[model samples]
Target: MQETIDLAAGPQHPNQFALLRQRRFAPFFWTQFAGAANDNLFKFAFTVMVTYQLSVGWLPPKMAGLVIGALFILPFLLFSATSGQLTDKWDKTRMFRFVKNLEIGIMLLAAWGFYAANVPVLLGCTFLMGLHSTLFGPVKFAYLPQVLRSSELTGGNGMVEMGTFVAILLGNVAGGLLVAVPEIGHLQVAIACVALAVVGRVVAQFIPSAPATDPGLVVNWNPVTETWRNLRLAHGNLVVFRSLLGISWMWFFGAVFLSQFPSFAKEVLHGDEQVASLLLVVFSIGIGTGSLLCEVLSRRHVEIGLVPLGAIGMSVFAIDLYFASRGLPPADGLHLLAFVSQPAHWRVIADLALLSLFAGLYSVPMYALIQMRSQPTHRARIIAANNILNALFMIASSVIAGALLGAGASIPQIFLCVGIANAVVAGYIFLLVPEYLLRFVAWMVSHIVYRFKVRGDEHIPVEGAAILACNHVSFVDAVLLMAASPRPIVFLMDHRIFRVPVLGWLFRLAKAIPIAPRAEDPVAYEAAFAAAAKVLQDGNLLGIFPEGGITRDGTLQPFKGGIMKILETAPVPVVPMALTNLWGSYFSRVEQGGAMVRPFRRGVFNRVGLNVGAAMTVAETTPEALRARVDTLLRART
Candidate 1:
């Protein structure tokens, strides 16, 4: 049982409005926006220049593609190891400003290259830009978990992704359009790149400086040794490692689709350079829409349940893209308007949109998982591992693409291959780490079982340790507590329940602490008390049912002395709660003889209530006194 509040103040809700107004996150957001804009700005300009301006004969498409891929790959390989170390050792905001300054220099070089029509210099700038991103990557990820609440992670990441992809799409379009302008030509593209870089720097200046959390840390700059070392640490956690792989695989799937656009547009769609541009637009827009939708769909919290759904969509839509482009007349420079008029092209458009939407849904949750799960001190190192895997997976994608394309596979077929591969990879990872799946099941069950409404939830302190005491009303009291509590809980449950069939497996998986009543098993009782105290001392939430067992008569039971013992030992704040109308549920063993309703026989769809009281300090609690207090709280609600 839980309580709910209607926070339906719409998109411009006061809380969201206050969040956006914050100095710390707002400027950081725009700095990323500018960085993404400039990255695609230069890439789009360089691609056009190489094909139209530099090529006197037929351009070696595969070779050009490989060079472009290398530019993106080199930074992650060469700099991210050092970058992660720097992020951990220094102030992230200050480091971000320095990275932005480096971007300014890179853009100036790109601007000159465009003006001189110097392809080599432009390529050099691309490599430099990638290096900047490499350095920024760890800091970008590690900074958010430090600044935002656990509940805010999903929405924050979604907003970042949305801003990034939207910027990429606009930059790609703007880059091409600027270069093509008759009065400015290629030089205008460079000019715009420099301007965006400057804008990025301006925003970076406004970003609130963050002091280093680990200032006494040693810095290691060796890419090969350190990168491998980082990956080793990240892989130590089986679930975290698998989540990283799932994320990397998504990038591989995305990169394959993005890299083949020019050829796909020219050969398959029979469209011009602008058509390739439009493909970029559609993909970016789809990703942006999907990214923003994550916050709304998840109700502003991280929900890994959506990951499976996204994987399913990615495979299905990608396969559709294969069939969508089949039997099309080859393209050879038809303009944008003409391309749109073609009825068959609409399938390609729809496939791209769905593919991107699913991709957005897929990637956001994995990021949140890493943030929530990774050890804080080693967070940057773990994120560094993510960057390394992303690079490797992306590089692998290029190799796979090259091999398949060389084997005479079509671009659409490659899309299908990557998409199907994503499904297989995602499924395997989730199967190995069933927590993601189990959480989804638990979340769904609680949501459907009753209309949970939380009130005065703000009284549940945000940080440090505390003890939560409520009546034992049902078998799933712990599960309901987990859903209602914002933080992860170290729950004390009966040893008997801990051995019960399928649910026993769940409790064990959750790492729940088991105890037997003193009368039943003295040793287990002692162990439970010790475990509960240790958890509170270590700064984790501890939930205990003061009632000790489920109510047999649908009336409040005497408060157990166990809670008082643990509280006195740990000296943490106590939060009292009352559960109403759950006595007839299947979990409650009611009416064995002369009790109220047969609680276990009350099927599904039973309405229940949970009312949370304000916190009580350790000094205010006594076994007798707290029992009276809880009795009064429950009586009022009843």
Candidate 2:
């Protein structure tokens, strides 16, 4: 029998770019890229044809655009529930091949539609293409978590997003240019679509098998009833459901921005196709760059902090974009070069780029969080519900945009309104779950307030139940640990700390267990121990300050028996860690008069270190032993 080595155990820190070199990730990435490119290619080609070429069957160009939009979105509304069920019930690899083959068939039909200039056939192909995407959506997302380790999820999703936007850019440019050719324009589009479809299928054949999440899941056929059931399943998990909302809101925001590109280019910039293409390229590149950066900024963890950061940037840049485009001059036939020749246009481009970069930062982590949090069995269905919500949000954006435009709002004004609305919606969601805000604060503090260096991080297990016994040096020790560790830790904190003003809310949001001294409050202490035990029993990491409070003298305090009591109940392995050089920091009491002070007492970017010792078996662990191990780690670092 071949021994299966755990990838998580093999490397403590794996770079995001490494996934691109692995078989499990590379092929699927290309397949998705090809598929996205083909979808946009056909859709863009048809839209261009409608706008410029043959007048079809009494429908105005604007009405035709709307009709095509409806056709594309109709399948998501009707077929996503069934598709989600299918993904859960069947092997994802096999289903992936089936979907790719379906795409080939759909593209063949699209080819003929393009060749014949047949409006009805093209519209039918659009609907079928949407159905193909609808079927692929759930599998595409849910498949990542199964194949990649927990740490790699963020990077994998980042690559996927980066590949997707790059593909979209290529497809739009190729489609628009190809369909504009004099005689063979339609044929050219047809051939490109068929060729890309074939390439996508070839890539799909190389994807390894992903076992069925729920092989016995009975496929639900009714769209309405199943859709309701799927929504209910999603609603059952508040965090997952809220993540779905965040993801959907991003789509709504994106659709509004993207849908305005052509019109905004023509009316505001007085530019032609080349200028529109330029805008598309800049936005796509920005998103791709930001997506790739998410893994770097997160340090290979799914940092939810980026979501709020992204949301804030999106609104800020979008508002700036509105202002930048205001009062622009008319340059009737301005091409890309001429537009770039002018200095004022640079601001518009900068706004779009920054807006897109933040959008990427906002989205990649949320997808990772959803995949990480959702139940494995019903993950696909939850993703399906997410897709449904995304479609609905996109549709709602269109409706709202139309209403605004009909009411005499220019495209830039609409952009401004969406930006303001984004702030309101994001604020509301953050209020509903302060975890997002708390995470942002932790991330910022670790990255901005203190420069944290970690050693022996490999000693910490990537999954399953474990107890982390550490000596807390400052108030922000938990935050530092959270930023360093790959998995979330349930910290056992003093109840008094939980009563402090702003920090209290943050600790509560992190779901920290609040313990009291046994002599002071026997009931609270017992409850805190019970909660700690439950956290470990659920196979999560529980962190406790074995000294029971922040160190006031920059030295390890004698260990308390609470650690032993919790270990006696849960009996999980204990990993001892130590924090060094945090004693005189702003949050520490080592400042003048032993009072906590802020604003760079240690100057900017003060060095702090966390050394994680090896895990100790429960049979050998005790208060004295664990404290000794942590002191040894601290001494070695010092």
Candidate 3:
């Protein structure tokens, strides 16, 4: 077995959706899709049966609904902690196989319950299904980060989420139709569920066994305590924790609107069950469309800009949903298909789709961000926190909806109120976490106007620490490097240059390390060396331009000793890279032979290139040898 991680270096995953096509990832995705379908199909069947078919002599409507919900969610609340530990301790493929087998058994129980017409047995089956889901949850999320390239995380998660939600919509619709089949009997629904389970099992069989990252992980069976502990791990990083919370809040917002849909259709739009179901279809399509569109809008990168955009769209449509229902009378049990053709009902459809679309845009990035930022060892635990919070938030949404209804508000009114609340929630989250907005700005600026094209990126190591040697191309080189390279790059620069009026502030804000040449400022130079060593020790990439200043002749300058000093201390790998064509770009100085620097001189839309060379071992690196190698590499690329 390879003890070290395999690195797929530079411009990897050209097709952002390649994760979906990989053997390891395809099985995992189908497993999730199958699980989501099963969950929704079972829930919809139970809800429709209890609401429309059951003779509720003893149970109240709300009480019956609550009991059904409890049966479905309780297992997640109870077994999720243990499942999370299992995902960490065992080989994920074997564990995933076990869960798929468990699903087949649960589906058999469901069949038995349906045939016996036993509500208690059916409810018990629901709990077992939830248990299966809870176990699969951690493995589902944690496994993605292991297989996908860093650049592919957002697109991969987007596709997965899109598939999951779309499956849910199909499952719900299919279950309703299946249960109504004549002569075929209720066994049809049971067979369908079993068939989906069989498909899921087949997919699980193809999954490559992912080795455990934390094989020594201890099992934490106590749900209450373990849940809190998992939450603490998620909370360890402010950005990651907040992103997780944002995801939960979105669920909270979604649950509120979804729970009241039937009422909204009947009381507000004057339609029947079919119309309410149509509203669900609209929302599902909207969300799935928005989720899939994320890859396009973001250019397969994580662009938090859309988060704010989605929030705005959600609020706008939600408020419109309220106004559209104004002056409308309650339905006198009219069938939805007949009523939906009326011109007045289009507003509801528009509202439902827009709300779901924005929600899709809003939620996908948070998942991507969490996957990108969280530590590998604890990623699954954090996703477990997400699952726990999703459940809690959904529960709270029900409570909130109940409270609003009890206070005598109409369904349309509740939607309008929540839409307004969504706007407020979004604004608050963005304000509290400005990084999302900032990253969007940076990402767009680089990808759009500059059209950065990196060449020879394979030279960078896939893992471990490395010091990057580059020919300074422009003021934005560090940010460009940060964006181009999958790993974060810490740059060392001249203190005076870093302190330059406006550009200096930008560099400081980006956290670039500043150093003065030893003859000019010995203290700062020593500090730079120390800082570079610390960064390498922490397993981060450090970028330094050997030219020490922009080239006057647009040709290579001899490398300085800083590279030698850093390598002596850190002794990791030294990867040489070159930036060409950017010298004539907007951020570049561009003046030849003592000419003063110009600002935005060439304007945007300039072509730029970054060429990276393979890692140089410490033993082979002396100042002369390193400089010669870098010069040769840069010249060859240019």
Candidate 4:
């Protein structure tokens, strides 16, 4: 059984670096880092061998690359569901130990394959490695949320993402360089793989134990049925399922770009292995930097707003990459330095780097969201379903790229096509879930239009249900609160506000509860309270402007009874929040007769403050008391 944890207890680590200093996170970090590096190291070495040194009478270079890709991806399709079930049924830390040990054995087989120059054995090892990864994938992600506090999820995921890409960069460079070292290339790769495997195992041994999320879950061995079951579970939740699609699409986008790099470098730029490695380095570094930046940009929240921003950047930069590389002079055997010497090539590299940076922005939050939203009992299985989809998407990308290229389309054309497709897909997704776009707008308004400073935000619970009572000072009060919050909040607003044009659409998209005055519509007023109660029962944050509506004056209005009624029904902790310095803002009804109502009346970058007070118990949460607490917080400068 899962132990009850206090969701109100904030994160132990303020940043990713603090997480690295803790044993609970560090060991698992290094273990996964080693595993990612080893996987790429072996895979890159094998690809180079097939493309350059191997002379298989049966398999051409292209066929070999295709076979290798298929071999690695096959395990995900075949075993992800089963792996998910196993992770849920068994102890995760013990499973990690076993998986790491399995890696060592796989590396040993790889060594023999390299030593004997056996094509079949090398391919078999690739398949085995894929299986190893499939088994570990669910555990790797699920383990983090279990160990880290809710507030740390974003930062922890950022560290993992950054580490994975850095590992990939190192692996690709080392593997490519080693494979080109004449006769002893295979031996060098074999040694490195084995050494990395052993180090990974040692690190795994130090990983703190994390109990299984669902110890009573029965293992389902049938991959076909289990895969369907897991997918259905994911689909049951619209947000989680859409997040899965978003993550899979990112993989599809990345696969198309990364898989084509070597060929693009050779055929388009007419560059050698070093140039390919340089491309990998630039892209990988961008991803790492962006991943780390998510923590800072989000202020430790799992901000999905970054997803749309990432999608837009990816499309724009990808299209630019096509244009930048469209008419480059092809110089055969051009090295990294030579490629960089040209000014146009720098544009190409810049595009690649920017695309990758957006990819990091695109992916990390989705991962954190999935972890945060999914039912804990089945989180691992949900992740497995995600892996399955990711593999399928990547495989589909290769097939699509091959078909497009086979039809005489240039690499730049493929890039352009993919970029256009990304924009279309992103539009469809944003339409389906307007909250993503809404949040993006809220984030932008908070950061760009109004400079927001928050204090005592930790007073809001990270996970459990809580009621937030705040003074309503402006029309955008809820948007500002949502922007400041680390978790998604359901706001209770006046029904009239829900009828406003674009803002109403966003309010509805955010699932805000619309309340009417009791004198106007008793039924809707009662329904609103019921909705607020349900939100609390469902373990979500619900925000209410206890003043009933935006203040007509610049000062606090009398507290309404609706908050007491909602609290009486839900009996959850009430967190008092204050929004300050917005009485004269554009969104505020500050001037008499509303004559001064206009956008940017205070100009761009108006200063605003949000002060969150400690949560009060239901017994101490009368409207009068809560109002006093909020007033106190409002009076203090944030």
lDDT of 4 by residue, 149-173 (tens): 7668888898999999999889988
- Which residue pairs collide in model 4, if any? none
Q: State in Å the error of residue 383, model 3.
A: 2.7
Cα-based TM-score, every candidate: 0.84, 0.95, 0.83, 0.95
| Clash count, one per candidate | 7, 0, 1, 0
Which clashing pairs does model 3 show? Answer: 459-613
lDDT of 1 by residue, 585-612 (tens): 7666666643224544656666666667
Give candidate 3 misplaced runs (Cα > 4 Å).
Answer: 1-22, 62-66, 147-152, 182-185, 236-239, 267-272, 293-365, 368-379, 405-438, 494-509, 516-522, 549-559, 590-604, 619-638
What Cα-based lDDT does every candidate model obtain?
A: 0.78, 0.89, 0.77, 0.89
List per-candidate RMSD values in Å.
5.9, 2.3, 4.6, 2.4
Pick out the ten consecutive residues of candidate 1 with the lowest summed lDDT: 1-10
lDDT of 2 by residue, 275-311 (tens): 8888889999999999999998987788888889999
The residue pairs in collision within model 1 are 2-453, 3-453, 3-454, 4-453, 4-454, 270-331, 270-332
Two-way lDDT contest, 1 vs 2, winner? 2
In order of lDDT, best first, we have: 4, 2, 1, 3
Between candidates 3 and 4, the TM-score winner:
4
Provide the lDDT at 362 for model 3. 89
* Model 1 C-alpha RMSD to native: 5.9
Q: Let me know the TM-score candidate 4 reaches against the reference structure.
A: 0.95
Candidate 4 at 197: error in angstroms?
0.5
